[model samples]
Target: MEVQLEQNEKKGKAFIDKDGKTLAEMTFSMAGTKQLIIDHTEVSDELRGMGAGRQLLQKIVDMAREESLKIIPLCPYAKSVFDKDDSIQDVLRQ
Candidate 1:
């Protein structure tokens, strides 16, 4: 299994496997000056528990960090993922 992260403009997505076989994905819109609102996060059931979600989130986080963007996880999955994670909390709204 392979995962890939791709982004365009102010939108970002994490795609797993080629041929559009997405295992987990996240969508977000930029809000200028290192700030963004995460709209959604989805992980295929079959891919769940395999760390795919974390991989996807990591990719998104890396992108955000590289672009110096803060994040507001509006999606439940995203929020929950971060709730227990301290590593990515620096990018979250305080």
Candidate 2:
């Protein structure tokens, strides 16, 4: 599944769509140009336990790195993922 992105002005999301239905997504707000405020994440029942949340997080993480930006994981799930994973911490905003 490919992660798609949609953004307008202040907010945006990294999402996966399967046959026109969203399977998973991570939403965020643009914090100026140097930071991203990741505020929420959700996965469909079909994607539960399949790492869909992480997948969406990774997509945003990669975007952050590419843009030389940091991420503040305000969402509980996103914060939990950032807490457990040391490898992705480079893009995290402390």
Candidate 3:
């Protein structure tokens, strides 16, 4: 499945799968002008071990790079990814 992103001013979500069934999803809330607080991440049982959660985080990281925004990974999953990847330090909120 391909990850897709949707966002407005206050919030955003990265998700995947077809039809109305969401195979996985990660959500974030806007913080001030240049940061996003990742608050939630979920992957369906059938999609587990498929790296769907990582895919969503990667998409969010790409979006953050494109928009020049920092990430405050409040969600444990997201924070773990950020902690393990040094390359994402540029966009990590200090």
> Quick one: best lDDT, which candidate?
3
Which digits, one per residue and each the tens of the lDDT, describe model 3 over residues 1-94? 8999999989999999778788899999999988999999999998999899999999999999999999999999999998998988899988
lDDT digits (tens) for residues 11-93 of candidate 1: 76776764656667777777776787888877888888888777777877887788777888898888998999998997887
Q: List the residue pairs that clash in candidate 2.
A: none
Give the winner by TM-score: 1 or 2: 2
State candidate 1's TM-score: 0.83
The TM-scores, one per candidate, come to 0.83, 0.94, 0.95
RMSD of 3: 0.9
For each candidate, the alpha-carbon lDDT, in order, equals 0.78, 0.92, 0.94
Q: Tell how far residue 48 is off in model 2, in angstroms.
A: 0.5
Descending-lDDT candidate ranking? 3, 2, 1
Please state every model's RMSD to the true fold in angstroms: 1.8, 0.9, 0.9
